[model samples]
Each structure stands twice: as structure tokens, then as C-alpha cells.
Target chain A: MFVRNILSAIIISVAPVSSVLAAGGDTPPIPSQDWSFSGPFGTYDKAALQRGYKIYREVCASCHSMKRVRFRNLEALGYNEDQIKAIAAEYSVEDGPNEDGDMFERAALPSDAFISPFPNDNAAKAANGGAFPPDLSLMTKARANGSNYVHALMTGYKDKLPHGVELSDGQYWNTYFTGNKIAMAPPLMDESISYEDGTIETLDQYAKDISHFLTWAADPYMEERKRTGFKVILFLLIFAGVMYGVKRRIWSNIH
Target chain B: MSNAPREKFDNTVVEWVDSRLPIFTMMKNEYGVFPTPRNFNWFWNFGAIAMFMLITMIATGIVLAMHYTADTKLAFDSVERIMRDVNGGWLIRYIHMNGASFFFIAVYIHIFRGMYYGSYKAPRELLWILGVIIFLLMMATAFIGYVLPWGQMSLWGATVITNLFSAIPFVGESIVTLLWGGFSIDNPTLTRFFALHYLLPFVIVGVVLLHIWALHVTGSNNPLGLEPKSKKDTLPFHPYYTSKDFFGIIVFIIFYAIFIFYMPDALGHPDNYIPANPLVTPPHIVPEWYFLPFYAILRAVTFNMNIYMLAGLGLLAVFMVEFIWRHKPKYLNGFLGFLLLVLGSGLAVFGLLADLNQGWEIPMSAANLAPISAKFGGVLAMFGSIGLLVILPWLDNHPIRSARFRPLFRIFMIIFTISVFILGYAGSQAADKVYFMEFNNTMLAQIFTGFYFMFFLIILPLLSRFEKGRELPKSINEAVLSKAQKAGA
Candidate 1:
């Protein structure tokens, strides 16, 4: 029994060793970038942001309100502050702190809400059936692949989109919608927004950047987060190297 | 001299980053060595993977719970609002949803690893028991979480499972109402399920810590089922095992990320796409696939067949076998024990496939959808799992002090292999629905389920008799040398 037991043990032990040895023939590749909190942030193109803003102003701003953003905040993304104020002055906003502590109407300050496309909630819903067109302020960060999904939804419309499905006159179809059967119509057009840079002419680019800017608006601190993560990882890596030698020293007597 | 203190501090940070993080140090101090075994194979890394899944679930869940409201009016809309309005909420939700499935995948692998390596044998019994406890808690937590989404599937899954208690003789109605907190599944049920689901993962975490503690006390059982006898038999765990575990975690995370980002909804049920409607029942309700085996067992006991007499007795017998029988190892009757185990596992798999019948889509019409038979496959698979597990100790007939001399045990291993194949075939055959109630022979069916129980309880003690097996090996080296000579000749 002792012999058999010992024999069985050796077989079990040796099989794994051979398997481990066999693994050297098929070396798995390592990822180029080790993703961590410290990994470099994904970069956005500047031209994309300018076009995205135009799309937002022309298409999205009509129905939705970015109540949290100031017109001046646009300058932080490379637009001049003067240009920001000029943009803000175009919108009429509700004001306060008057004799009754509530002034009724004024030109928008840096703190004003973006212009609403519809006159009211009822009008917006009436135009698009009973379903409410959601606010776009944070839509890019609200859903997984929000920018791509939104962009796909905007450009996905086709006549006779699929099967015998009938679309309402104003309602459009998007190929990229989750169920491929969304209620919302295609909202953007190539000629809808004319830009100084001649870039917003593309239907796809317009959809892409509006999505990007919305993403940025939702998580403005993304750049800061990525930078901090990188430094922490660097510090940890250096610390690990020094500790290895210490561990070796501590366990030297065990051998 | 003043530079000495600064140099030391810098050195400490460097060392901590590379080899001596406070976490690692604490683990080392608690575990008492590095790279303790050089040969754990791929299976040992699963515990760490399981840990990673838990951490992922907790992090994503905390973020999701922040935006979620438990009110009846706002619950569904709250989910929609999170999808449309909250920053990064979509990613958080997707990660949490996929994370649950990934956690189960890791736990299943860990359990199978334990089984393959004989990690549950003898001294490591507490580890296995704690693992089972963790598994139970995990199931409870997941069931509760499923209800929180307030989807059609969630409502129906809850309704079906809770209704199972209605099969009880007299007090079943009261018991179910007590469980539901009312006569029907309503706001009280949803509120209670949400609360319990939120509470259960933390309970799992506590149980997991106990699982690891038990594992550490026994150290890890290696693939060879042999204990290390000398310093040459082991290595420090830090650089060796730590690196392997780290690599395993990274690979596991990559797969998890793919599920989180690309195919987040692949594991989800389509019925959940529709909002929860308490008034309407889904065409077919099924629990998550992980719960299918148990569901099958519960259903196998058809109504009108004294469920209390058969199912109640069967479950008690199983509990006693799993827990009480651990103390009396000699009572395990090797061959019949193996058959009983195979039968039980076949029944479990049969249950799983039965639940999956409606989920799969085919291009065929209703006329073509006449139920295909797979009942035989279910019985076989269930029995196969039970067979191998119960007969294992006897199958290793070549005196197992060391793995090197267990060549003759290979014959029994072949038996196990054939049994699994047959069981798998039977399970495939039993996947179709059984709709004939009048012809179903309900009493005879209960007898089969009862036999599945009796096989385990009655036959396990008789396996040792009529077992004049192959001669045992005399020494580890002798066994190895003899094999080598035979190969050469």
C-alpha cells in the first residue's frame, strides 16, 4: 500500500510538470498597454470637439437643456472666452435677484441653460408622440458606448429600413439602436449646420463629435483621473522592485 | 547619516511596490511562506479569480445602488433614467450585470478544480464545506439581485420559484404567503428580495474569508494528491505562485471586460427587455442557468405524488450524505457508490436542460415544434456526475501513498469516462418537454426520483464488498522503474 501510494503521488506530481514544460512551445503574447487606473487617458481630437459643439447647438439644444454648463466653459476646450460670451448672449434665460428676488427675462449669462428647441415639454412630447426625447446633457456617459451608440442612432435611418416595419413621417430608423426598433427618428442632416471650419458638413462627423462633447460634459474630470492613475502605478512599480530584494534576504536562511 | 533615513524610506517604498506591499506582507505573515508549492497547476488560480469577481461586483454594485431607488412607482423608470441620465451609469450597470455571470463561472471552475485535485479529501473537508456555504450564499444573493431590475423575467422567475412551495401538503400555502410577506408577490416581496439580495454578497464575502482560512490551514492540495515531504518539494509563494495568480487574474479580467463592454446583454434574458407587469405572466418562466439543476430536481418530484414523502426525504438524505457521512468514510461502498453518484448528477443536468427548452430559437414552425425527446440524456448525465464522485476513493485501488504507482487505477478511470459519455448522451435525449400528464405515470416517476435517493443512501455502504482488485504497488521508485522497463521492452 505504501509503495502504491508513493507511486501514485509521483505520477500526479510529474504529469503537471510535463504539462508546464509543454506550455513553453506556445508563448502567449502580453498586452502592449497594461490597463489600470494609471494608464494614459484616451485622447480626443480638437477639430472633433468644434464640430460636435455645432451639432449640439443646431440639433440637440432645441429640445434638451444643459442647465449645468456655462457658455464660457466652451473656452476651456480651446474657444476664446469672448466667443463664449457671444454664444451665451444669443439665448434668453430666466433671471433672479430682482426687487421680488425674481427677475423674469434676460440675455443668458455664462450660467444660462442652452436654448430649448421646443416651446415646452408638452410640445416636445406632442411632436414625438407620447415618448419624451431625453435630455442630452449627459447622454454620452449615461450609456455604455454612449457616443458610438448615439452616433449610430442619428445616422441609422433608411427608407424601408427592415421587413414590413412602417415608420411615422418624422420618425427615423437607426441601424445601431439596441433593439433595432427605436421610436426616435433620425435627427441630423449634412446641410443642417454650416461651420466656419467647413467640417460639420459630414453627417457622420457631426454625430461623432456631439457625442464626444456630451461625454466630456458628463465626466469633465476624466483627464485628471487618468493622470493620477499613471503616477500611482509608477510609484507602486518602483516600490515592488526594492521589496523583492528584501524578501529574498528575509527568506535566505530557509534554503 | 542624515541621508540614511531618507534612503531607507525610499528603499521601503521601492520594496513595497515590487515585493512587499502591506497587503502582500500581511498575507505572507498570515500564510507563513512564499511560493509554498511549485506545482498547483492552473486550477489553483481560480480562488484568486473568484476574489477578483467579488471585488468587481462590489465596486460596480456600490455605484449602481447609489442611483437606484427601491420604490414601486419609480423602480423601472429609475433604471431607464440611469441608462439615459446618470454619468457612467450604463457602464456601471453593465459591469455589475456581467460581473455576476463571471463570478459564477469562476466559482464553478474553483469547485471543479477542488474536485479534480481531491482538495476536499480528509483534512480539507472544512474548506469544501465552507466553499459550499459560500456557493449557497452566492445563489441567494443572485436571486435577490435578479428581482431588483423589476423586469418580466425577474417577476416571473420569482413567481415560479416561490410557487414551488405550493406543492406541499397542508401548510404549503401558509409557508409561501409567509415567504412572500403576503398572499401574492407584490411590493412587499420586491422590497424584501431587494433588501436580502443587497445583504447576501457581504455574507458571501464573510464565508469566502472562512473558505480561504480553511484552505490556508490545510495548505493547498496539489494535483498529485501527495503532501510535500521536504524543502525540495516546495518553493516560496511570492515570486512564483503570486506571478502565476497575477497572470491568471489579468487573463480573467480581459474576458470579463469583453463581456462588460462588447456583449454585455448576451447572458441576459430577452423577456427582461419588457418592463415588469405583475398582471401578465411570461409565456415561459425559467431561473438563471446556474439554478437550473436544482430546479430540475425540485420539478422531478411531480405534484400528486406525495412530494413531502419523496422530495422531503430525498433532500434530507442528500444533506445527511453531504454532511453527516463525512465522519464515517468507511461506509462509502465503492462501486454502487459510484453508480449512485453518476445517477444523481445525471438528474441535475437533466433538470438544467429541461429548463433551457424554450430559450433556444429555431426557424421551425409550431407544427415542427413537436417536443423532441432528451429524457434519457438527462438521467444519464445526472447519474454520471454522481457515479464518478462517489466511486473515486475505491477507483484509486493501487494504494495511493504517491501518485506514481496508481497505473491500475487507470482502469477504473476508464469506467468513469465511459459512464460520463453515456450520461451525457442520456441528458441530450431528455432536453425536450414532457407534456403528457395523464400518461406521465406520476407515481412511477416519484419512484425513480426515490430510487435516485435510495441508490445513494442504501448502496454507498455496500461498494467495498466483492472488490478483490489489482495488486497494489510496493514503492514509488519501483512503480516508476517498472513502467519504464515495460515501455522499453
Candidate 2:
């Protein structure tokens, strides 16, 4: 009866977890996407990340900002120091007051974070029709379903609306957004961005690449974290075994 | 009087320090040769693991604070900087973040162990109360520390929790303003939370010392819940329990590290990655998992009216008189038992009543909507849950300490634990439309909240008064021997 009670307790306790997850509104589930960094032993695909970086630079950079990342941090994308320096020099950053007591624009350094096109939030919102374009630094982590959600949203824009669904003036219909209507129009198109390495230039390919890049952007140290976890767990298991033996030896004399 | 005698060490340097301060002698007496009950189960290891987690949190927290900024505008950016720029900052930050969850897990198991074996009874009442004080302090520290990140959840969570104070009658608004140090949870609130977040842990440490001091005075209560009668019933604390505790810590850390490294955000709300924006609110807002059971209690239906509800109301009046003459079991059992039976019947009636009321969404008319009074009632329920724990020793007057021997109390405990879990699950989902078993989240919370309160207020007292538990083993040694013989060891 005691064992049965414990079993029932566990079963009853776990029942709510499934229900809680199921209460994610009426939206269709975000289908999982295959990625290089999907499993415990997974590592980032450098080529895909590089292509994804290009997509971010050309497309997303027009509105969204990656303010948390620095050019030097781009080394994670398999970029060399000189290449990072060259990339940093492309963007101009606002610098300190000069002798004339005025802020000046200077060439960005390797340590400088990604520069914003708009000076402030008000300006950013003004340029984007009163809707603030949020930063992309931790976008994947900020949303549920992470990479899959981003990928689906990117490819989910519908030219034909579902029956009885009417969109507002600037709104577009998407299958993934909590509300079917979205503020931003479709951003990806087939053959829109040319690839230097003979990679396919489809809208779906672009969406997947960008999603992968965003995942890496949100969690840069994931591979290192997993690696360290492996070592720590292995050492602990062995140590625990030895401690169990020691405890047995010590208690044997008494009990 | 300088009480205890110093130990004489064979080493001349050790002998000199021992004679002067007796600090070494104190350690020797308290930790080295302290007599501990021999029949302690694996549950006893949680106290040691909790201590290890506390130290881990403090160590990682100090390093995280060195890089963390506490202002509203800069706080989020500073945390991002720690993750990106600082050396091994992600590691330190993740450990500190997940350590709070892990520490709570340890302390919760420790508390449950005490409850199961009746460690809080008799001479150890103060020790149990001190442990509850530590739990409260830990909650305060964890809440304030959560705000240091200044994310969307941090801003909104701090807003929701602090606003709960306004449910009080007169000085409520003033108390809130004082707590915020301004009109809203702004820069001032962030800075003060940071200060208190750092301060409360040290205060918890001081209380923990007192908790341990109290424990040493009374000694430990074992699984058998019997006092040791002879040396054969106990063993020294050092090699015996120390090795056991070390094994527990290592095993516990292996799981801790998995969460830290593999799925660091498993227990976290994803919305927190966004920077704080006071204007925008996330569609769903939930507290940390540790606080969820209380959160569910805080939001449970307070004034919903129906047939079961009306009958329960009539019982409340009779219960008042029963409270006045609680010692008289004749009246106590008749009235209280009838009252509980009525309410207990309603537990399965949730589905039948589901069709009666619409969802619990806001913006309903004042007539049927959750009213202003509901907020105060919710606040009372949430706080009353913790307040009950502080008076738990007084509540259960049973002579038998171990629930192992008390079949009825053990069953009630299982029911109570399941209710808490149900409440936690209900806390996570939307509290409106029916999602499970023809009942909504709010309804689930209400039912479980009834069970949770019933466990303490009715079930414990009545059972403790009347229960004739099974006969116990003669001593701790006998209990251990019987267990070994049963196992064919």
C-alpha cells in the first residue's frame, strides 16, 4: 500500500505538467526543426552560421538591433581577429565629447557592440509605424519554442487569409503568431539574397539559416557548458561511488 | 562560567591554541564526537546538502554581483555583459541562478523529512521554528535577487508582488509606497531590492547557526522517532555521517550541474530575456516554481457561491462554537466531521458545477467578477499557508512521532502532498476555461487549497487527538536490527 501510494502520488503530480503545457492557447504547435546544435554532443555548423550572419546583416539589420554582441565576439562565428576588426570598422559608433564639447562619430573598434540605425527607441518606433522593433540579441531565448518559433514565423506569412479572417491595414496573416495577424510583412523571399558559396537561395533556407544563427546568438557558450557538464558529472559519479564505499566501511564497525 | 573543558592534543601547537581559545575543543565536541542516532534514513542527508547549496549560492552570488549593476536602465545590460564579456561569468551566473532552485529542493525535502519523522515535536520545536524562519528568509532573498536582472518578468513580477500589499485596509498604500521608495517599482525599488538581496542571506546564515545550536542541544530525531537509550543506539558524527553526507552532496551536485550546463533555462520563464518595459505586459505571468503553490492559493476563488458553498458556510458557524470547545471531542468530532464530509463531497462535484459559471477572466461585471474583497482574501490565504508552518508543532499533539507507525496520518500526508502538486500545476496554466476533468484552473486551485488548509486545520488536530498508532520498536538499535534482519543483511 505504501509503494502504491507513492506511485499514485507521482502519477497525480505529473498529470498537471502536461495540462499546463497544453494550455498554450489554441495556436498550432510549432514543429521542431533539425539543427546542428540540437543534441548533447551537438556543435554549431560554422558555414551555416556564417551564411546566417550575412542574412542578419543584410535583412534584419535594417530594423532590429543586435546590441548585446560585439565585433570581437564574432570569433564564435569562425571569424579571425582581422576579419572581426574589418567588420567593426564598417559601422560608426558615437564617441565621447571632443575638445569642442560635442559628441562625435568615430570608426567602431573590435570591442564595440553592434550599432543601431536609429538614435533612440522613439526614433526606432517612428521609423517602424509606431511598433518598436525589439533587439535580436536574445530573441531566441526570449520566446517559447526558440528557433522553431522564429523559423515558423519567418515562413508562416500567408498571401491568402484563412476563411472569415480579415487583417487590419498594416497587419499580415501568419499561422504561428499568437494572434494570426502580424505587424511586419514577409521578410524572406526566394533568390532575394545571393549566396557566395553556391548554397541554395530559397526563402525556407534563409529562414532556417537565420534561426540557427539566432540560437547561437542567444546561447554562445552552450557547447562549452555541455562539455564542462560531462566532465563534472563523470567525476562526481566516480567520487560518489568512492564515498559510498567509505561510508559503508565506516558504518560497518558500528552497525 | 567558562563552561566546557579544553581537549589536550599530543601536538604542542594544537594544545596551545586549544588551551587559549577552546575553539578547536568546541569543534571536537560538537562535530567530531557528537552522538547521533544510528538508524537515520537517507532523508536525513538533505540537511547537509542544503548547507552545501547555501554555500554554493553565496560563493557564486558574490562573483555575479561584482559584475551586476542594479539600476533599472543598466541592470539588464549589465547581466548581458556578464554572460558575454566576463570570464567564466556564464558559469558563475548559471550556478547562482539554478542554485536557488536546487537549494529550495534540498530544504523542502529536509522539511518534509522533519514532518515525516516528527523532528519538530517536543524539545526540538524551537529548532523547527528556526528552520521555517530560514525558509522565509530564503524566499525573501530569492525574490529580491530575481529582480536584480531587471528583465520583463522581473519588472512585472516585482510590480505584481509589491502591489499585493495594497490589499490591506488602511496603511496598505503607505506601506507599498515606502517599500517602493517611490510611486512605482522604478529605479529606487531596483536599488533597494539589490541591497536587501545581499543582506538577507547573511541574516539567514546567522539564523542557521541558531538552528544548528538548537539541534545540538536536543540532538537529532531519527526515522524510528525514538530517543537513543544507550551507546549501541548511536554512533559518532564524524566518519559515520560525514562520509554519508559527502556521498549525498556529490550525488545532488551531479543533478545540479546537469541543469546548470545542459538546460540552464529549464526552470526559468523565457520572457525574462526581454529587457524591462513597464508599458508592455506579457500575456501570461507566473511566479517561480517554488512559489507557485502559494501563488495558486493566492488566486483561488474566494467568494464563489453555490449549494456546496452555502452548506460549507453553515458549517463555518458551527465550527466557530467547536473552536470554543475544541477539547470536547463529542461536539468537536460531530460538527467538524459533518462539516468536512460536506466539503469533501464537493471535491468530486467540481465537474457538475463547471456548467454553472463562466470563465474567471477579468472585465466581467462587478456582480459576478472577482471583486476587491477577493484580493484581500487571496492574500490572507497565501500568507496563512506559511503562517501555519510556524505553528505546526502546536497543531499536531500526537504522542507518536513517526508517521510510519501512524497509518491514517500517513495517508492524509500523501493526500496533502498531492494537493500541493495539483495546486502547483494549476498555478502554471491559465485560470479561466475548463482545461482538465471539466474543471478550470481556478476551480482546481480552489479545491486543492481546501485540501491544503484541511490537512493542517482539521485532519492533523483530529487525528493527533484520537489516533492510536502502531507499537514502536524498543530502541533505535532494535529498529535498525529488525530492518537489517528483514533485508537478510
Candidate 3:
């Protein structure tokens, strides 16, 4: 009876789908892609992380700021402390007031957040034609189907608008974007950044890499979370088994 | 009480402590040798599981609170900080988040088990009522906790639900303002919500204590719906049921770990990741999945009372005709029953179709006479759905306790379950527009909402009179013996 009821319920719930097909026209479906860190045992691919960091530095970093991540955090992506120090030193960051009580610029330390190109939200908006460049810190978590949406938007730019549609001046057509028009133009091109590890530098590879890097930025503890979860579950199984044995021994004389 | 002899401490220190506090005596009385029906199956394990979940949530919640900021501007960032900066904070937050979901899951199963076995009958009525009270406190706690995240759903959900008070008559506006701590959900609202969210769980803990005390007073209802007649029919709660509860907890924790580790966001709304934006309303706004059935009931009230009056009158006519034709009511039901059924079905179909089209056009004269607006009706419907549960112990007047013996009651139970699922599905749909069918989602919601109330208020009481229940086993021992004999054969 339970199975039958469940089956009937499923049928009733699913029966309306055919009638609602037209309702889905508003937002285009997001395409799915495989990730190295997709499952319980999955971990970040270190080589991709390095290439992704390079692509971010060369292309996207000028527009987007990963304000939540410090230069030292690059160690998680396989960078040594000296390399991190060198990278941080390459960028000049605003520092505290001197004896004159005025702000001054100094080479950034590894602890400093990746610097923003624009000073503030207003400046970012002004530079981008009224569209503020969003901070990249939690971008992977901010949208639905986050990584897929990011990858799709990067690769979805079209050379021509769909037949009847026309774009206003700065709007670029990207089929995956909500309105199929976006303020940011296509940021990646073929061979945009040469990887130090000799990996191919295709546009798709750059988009995927950056997506992976952003995902890590959003959830750096994914590896630890899965690891701890596995251990806890294993311990619980053994503990429960022991508890069952104790219970049997205690009740052995009864009933 | 169990026949097992109570253990006596021989040591002087143990005796002295026992004389002072009697803590061991209380524990021995309440848990060590407390008699429990041996016939209880896996379903009975949820109460223990729920208690464990409560502790897990409270423990995790206290730690999370230490690092959390209640200020609106920082609330969102603080949560992000907890996830990114604090050591082991992600695990704590995930446990709390997924814990809320699991808590509801366990409680729902627990409530359904009570309903299935007639556990709320007779001496256990107060126990059932206390459970209902706990359920209400839980809903309130979950609602405010959802807002503490300061996400899009949090802000907008706060606005929508707090505004529900505006359905009241004269002081509605003031009540909403008072609740919000201002004209809108803002800094004070977030601070107060955080305070209340922190406080209510402790309140729930208190009520849970009273609930358990009541449970102990009445003892547990077994699957057979028979009280133990002798000690042989029961087992000590300690050693036996405690081990069972431990096993249940481990199993439940495994399920929780899957959500926390593998698919943390599976139960969460994606829009919640975005910080609250008052200017941009989400395309569709829905509450957490646990609240869907009630949310759907609220949205279902799209039409005024004309439809309800018509349907009520039609049902009354059917009942009257059946009453007059008493002896041969079954054969007399064909033509009129078919006609009335079609009329009822047509009214429902029209209501849903009209809701899809927008709303039913109420005649100007009838509009004022319509006791309340549809919005207010929706609020009443939502609250009424929970309120109906309080009276369930009385509504069910069956001689037999468990549905195992009541074939007709079992059918109604199935219908009740289906209606709830339908309401949940409707609730999950976008509230602004109808989808999936030509009929409006609100209209479908209303139809299911009608079934939900009817199951409790009408079907349960009415069916109890007509149902000829099957024979039930006289005692738990007999039931167990028969099962064993069948297995041996």
C-alpha cells in the first residue's frame, strides 16, 4: 500500500510537466560540466589550480577583486612561502598613516587581500559604465548552479545576435546569461595565458580553471570536511556495533 | 513497573550522595528499569533521535553564536567569515543548518507515528497536545533562524510573514510594526530575531521536558495499541531500548553526515547565497521545504466564501439525502451522488482554472459579506492547518486505537498523506504564477487544502461511525506470539 501510494503521488506530481514546458522559456538551462572535486573522494587538481590562478592574474584580476583571499592562501594551491612573498611584493597596497598622518603605498605582504583595481564601488561602477564589477570572493556561491553558470557565461558569448534580437551599445549577447545580454564582454580568448606546467591554454580550459579556483576560494575546507565526515561515520558504525553486542549480552537471560 | 529489582548502592559515599540529591534513584526510576512495550518497532526510535538532534543543534548553535554578528550590515559577512575564517566553523554551521532539516524530518516521522497508532487517544491526549505545542515553537524558531542568515530569502521571507499580521482587523498595522521593531525588517529586527532565535530553543527544551514527563506518566503506546497487562509484555528502557535508540542515533547521524559533507546545499535555496536585496524581489518566493505544506495552504485561499458556501451546501445536500434514504443509502447514492460529485468536482476545477486566470470575480454585493479578504483567509488557513492538529485526539472517536485494525481509517490516512504531499508540491511552486497545468497552482493548493481540513474535521469523525474495524490482538504478548508462530510455520 505504501509503495502504491508513493507511485500514485509521483505520477500525479509529474503529470503536469508536459503542460508547463512553455513556462521554462525565461531562463535558458545551464549546462553541466565535470569537476575534479565533484564527489565525496574528489580533491582539487593542483595543476589546474595553478593555471587558473595564472589566468586570474593575467585577465580577470584587473576587473575582479578576490577581497576575501589573502596572498598567503595561495599555499593551499601548492605555492611555497617565498613564491607567495614574491607574488605579494609585486602589488603595491595602501598602508597606514606615516608620521605626517597621511596614507602611503607600500609593497603588499602575503597577508594582504588581493588588491582591488578600483578604490570603491562607485569607482568600479564608473569605470564599467554603471555596472559594478562584483567582488570574486564568494562568486562561486552567489548564483544558482554557480560554477556551471560561470563557465557557461564565459563561453556563451555569440558573434551575432539571434535573428530578431538587437543589442544596445555596451550589451553583449551571451545565451547563458539571464537576459541573454551582459555588461561584461567575453573575457577569455584562445591561448590567453601560457601555463608554466606546459598545459594547453584553450579558452575552455581557462574558464574551467578559473571556475575551479573560485570554487576553492568559496570552500577551502571541502577536503577537510569530507575527511572528517568519513572518519566520524566509520567510528559511529563500530561504536553502534559494540553497543549492539553489549545490549545482546545484557538481554541474553531475558525472553 | 518492571519486575526487575532496583540496584542498591553499598558504598557510604554513594549512599550519602543518594540521600542528598537522590539523583541515582531518579535516574533508576525514570530510565534504568522503566517499562516499555517490547512491540515497538523502528518508528518509536524517532523520539530519542529527535532529542539527540536537539542537543546537537544546541551545542553547535552555541559555538556558532560566539562568532556570529547580529548586526544587519555584518550578519551576511559574519556567516561568510564563519565559513571561511574560523577553524572547524564550516562543519559547525553545516551541522546546524542540516540539523534543522533533520530535526523536522525526525519530528514529522514522530508525529505521523503517533497518528498511525492512535497514541494520542485517552490518557495520552495531553501528551499529543504538548507535542503540538512543541511543533509550533519549532516553526517559530526555524522561521527566525532562517532570517538570521540575512540572505535574500531571509529578508523577503521576513517581510512576507511579518506582513501576515496586517490581515488582522484594527491593530494589524501596529502589530506588524511592533513585531518588526519598526516599519520594516531592519537592524533591530535582526538583533531581536537573533536574540529570540537563541532563546526559543531553550524554551523548546523546557517544553520538551514537560512533553517527556507527560509521556512517562502515560507510558508508550505500542504498535498493537494495547497497554502492557503484565511485566512480561514489557522490557526495561535501559539496556534494551537505550541500545536501540543508540543504533537509531548512529543511523540518523550517517544520514545527516551525507547532507553536511556531500550535498550541503541540496536542501538550501540558491537565492539565499545572495545578500538580501530589497530592490530586487526573487522571481519566486517560497519558504523552506518543511514549511511548504502550510505555505501552500496559505496561498490556496485565492477565492472568497461563495465557492466554499456552494461546496458546503452541495455536501450537505448529499449527506441529507443519504440520511433520509438510511437503509438503502448505498443503492440510493448512485444518481444523486454522481450528480453531486460532478458538481463538487466542477466547482473545484473552476476554482483552480479561475485562479490560474487570476482570481474569481466576486459579485459586488457578495464581496462585502465575504467575512474576510482572501489574504486574511490564507493566513487563517495556514494557522488553522496546525490548529486542527490540536483537536485531533477528540476528532477521532474510533473504538479501536490503531489503524492496523481500521481498514476504512487506513484509507482516510492514505488520503490524508496524499493531500499533504500535494499541498507541499503546490507550495514549492512559484507563488506568483501558475505552472505545470492550465489550472492555477493556488487553485490546486486550495483544493488540497480543502482535503487537508476535511480529513481532520469531517472524514475522521464521520468515518469512525461507519467503519467496521477488523479484530485486534488482545495484548502485546499475543501479537508477538502470533507473529512468532507464523514465522516458525
Which prediction has the highest lDDT against the true structure? 2
Would candidate 1 be rated incorrect, acceptable, medium or high by CAPRI criteria? incorrect
Off by over 4 Å in 2: A1-25, B304-372, B436-438
Evaluation by lDDT, superior candidate among 1 and 3 = 3
Cα lDDT tens digits, model 2, A1-255, are 222122122223434754564453246889888988977778888888999999999999999989888888789999999999999999898897999999999999999988887888899989988878889989999998799999999998889977676777888888888777778878889999999989999999999999989999999998898888888888989999999999889878765
lDDT of each: 0.58, 0.83, 0.81
lDDT of 1 by residue, B147-235 (tens): 78887788777776565455344775687788688877778887888777778888888988888777766777775666655555566
Return the lDDT, model 3, position B58.
96
Evaluated on CA atoms against the true complex, candidate 3 attains a DockQ of 0.29
Judging by TM-score against the true structure, name the best candidate.
2
What residue pairs clash in candidate 2, if any at all?
Answer: none
lDDT of candidate 1 over A1-255, digit per residue (tens): 122122122213434543444343222221122112112456555566767777778777766656445576676468786777888888886666789887688887665556666767678888777666766655654444455556666676666765665666555555555435566656777777787886647777666667677766654445544454455445555554555555456445443
How good is model 2 by TM-score? 0.90
Worst 10 residues of 2 chain B by lDDT: B363-372
Report the C-alpha displacement of residue B174, candidate 2, in angstroms: 1.2
Cα deviation in Å at residue B59, candidate 2?
1.1
lDDT tens readout by residue for model 2, B254-299: 8998899888998999999999888886666778899999988987
User: Which has the better TM-score: candidate 2, or candidate 3?
Assistant: 2
In each prediction, how many residue pairs overlap at the backbone (N, C-alpha, C within less than 3 A)? 71, 0, 0
Query: Residue A9's C-alpha lDDT in candidate 1?
Result: 27
Clash pairs, candidate 3, are: none
